[model samples]
Target: MEKADSCRRAAVEAVADVEPPRLYEYIESVLDRASMVPAALTLESAAAMSPEDYVFEDQDGRHCAGESETDRDRTQISEYDSERIVTHAAGVQLIYEGLRLTRSLAHDEPWTVADDDADEGDLAILAADILVARGFYLLARTDAAGKAVRTVQSFGRDQTRRAELEPETASAVGPDGADSAPDSLDANLEHDVLELAVRAGAVAVDETPSPQLLAVATDLADAAGTSFPPVTECLTDLEAKVREQSLEDSTTDRATSATDP
Candidate 1:
């Protein structure tokens, strides 16, 4: 819960600078309750990490700092770097939520829109677009930007595949459509977003996530499915999982190094 709270605060702050009052209000409302699992995971991974090895020399071949200043520089880098990573996580999560909502409206048709009274549906569409754009804005300068973009691309492709597999109407689509269950292609958004979360988190501290860590992300995504549960419920033992994966990765690295010529 604390992690979620931290994530929410950071996410809200990230979007607080939006110029439009109404759009900002809509974004804030969504962030007020959006699942923070992705962002939380970023923070958790960051917490468990140490800074990357200090650069001994600049690109110009000049020494950057001495041992006396190394710790201070690392601390400063870690502080700002974690913020950037978590912000990227928040951005990706927003994009995922927006896409999810758009998909729900398109495929599920949760509500009807009268020809003359399309305000509600229009607003929802606008909000979804805004959320995704803002999310992209947040990730634009971060290391995870490419990953975030790919996640959205994957979501779009999967949705196209979903439409082919399952038509617009549930009952009318029949047996062929019925195979596309909630946990099938529909759940891929959650799966990919969670993986991105861990990756973004690990990279913040200069760590490449082990396969085991990513597997944990998959397991967590499967548990939540497409319902988008609160991260507090979904990531309850995330810290332990991260720690375990860290130790496992360290051991693998040691074994590999020991075997090297």
Candidate 2:
């Protein structure tokens, strides 16, 4: 549990000042609910776990502004993005979406969306009531509800995989534990989450189905082969890379806007 606490501490440090106190509390609750809380998590954690993860207004603005150009923005990027509403529900949604994406993306169809676009996608507002409110968001309101159902169904088909996935027992292991990698689909918890993280990253960056995205994730899987510390470090690196990329994108957006008029 020392590892979990360290992960939580790092996570807290990541958003202590930026996110509202309630949101931070909510995020903490979600992590605790997951039962396998890692030491530190990046935005990719949200993406990988909760495909329908919600974004705080400030976070979306940072993504839009590419505030990643500075260190301050980099430090504040992973605020409880998944727990937009109910706290622990983010954990449930993460499982649902990861399974959903693993099933959907397995198809040739594309699930790409701008980094911030998923904020309001049909899938964004889950109608789940298991842990939180049921019927909270009926499909009647979502323009993409039809597509969302397909995605959810796809995830449902493979529910067994999650059931088969073993929990990571060893604490703070790094990513080089190839020998320890379970023969199962995820190899273990970190692998499973990383797979979802990459998939989410692909969709968020509009790079789904791209080999490079998968490659990066695979590389991460190997590096963080099987533990929390490595996972934490991997998340930190991914966050910085994403931030830098966001900064560049923001700069380009500005340049294009200057030229377009």
Candidate 3:
């Protein structure tokens, strides 16, 4: 009875220490469901603005302007109809950076394990920590994008007219008298690449679980004159449980937020 209890405890503790897999899942979901237009435009703006301070305004009243004055009394101000595009570009970059961190972690070597006999619980804990970190990282990334999108949309919605007299405007009114921003698909592609990289990193981690190490744990338990079945079974069950719980929690939170006043 004592041995059985010990095995059960180890199994439970090991599983408890493993972090839920929902972090990656949530990030992936966001990437999948997000609006490609704004995200792409945002990324394009970030890239274009990398070397200069500029703004975008449209011919149809979607105008954005920026001004910078040198210490030598030279004032450089520019505007465009695509300010929202630029803002979205920056926002997408922020999200990409956050997602990159998780990808980096997924590729990094296990921090807690050195030898074959290391505790399974320790390994599980390390994995859990990585997942938790990823979750927070992605949440921050998505939040930044979300905030920027809202701000940009608000600005676009509030603007009543394009900067008609601004000579710096790149595009002119179309034959149909409609204004359009530059193509933003390139920026969207970059964001998509980042998201894909993140997913790939997660797949790598999931595929590379140290099965040998788990086997070693089983061997060790058997050598200690104990049954290994309970420990292994418990760890497996815990992993699934953690994943399910994390996903459920994430879904619930999203639903609640959507319904909230």
Winning candidate number (lDDT) = 1
Candidate 3 lDDT by residue in tens digits, 1-261: 221222222222222333345443433333333323222322222322223333333323332232233322422223332332333232333343333333333334345565542343344334444433333333244324343344234323322122232233355766765344321211232334333322222222222112222232233323322111233334333234323433454566589999999
- How would you encode candidate 2's per-residue C-alpha lDDT over 142-194 as one tens digit per residue? 22233334434444443445344335524434476532323233334344444
Residue-level lDDT of model 1, residues 1-261, one tens digit each, is 555665576667767877568767876887786877777666656544444433222223333222355444543343455456556567766777688778777775535657544555666677788778877887776667788888889888888887776644455543655554433887888888888777677776667766888887888788887866677675657767776776777788789999999
Candidate 1 has a TM-score of 0.77
Q: After superposing candidate 2, which stretches have Cα over 4 Å from the reference?
A: 1-30, 33-93, 96-189, 205-209, 230-232, 240-261
Which candidate, 2 or 3, would have the higher lDDT against the true structure?
2
lDDT of each: 0.68, 0.36, 0.32
RMSD of 3: 29.1
Off by over 4 Å in 1: 48-78, 110-112, 115-117, 168-183
In what order do the candidates fall by lDDT, top score first? 1, 2, 3
**Candidate order (TM-score):** 1, 2, 3
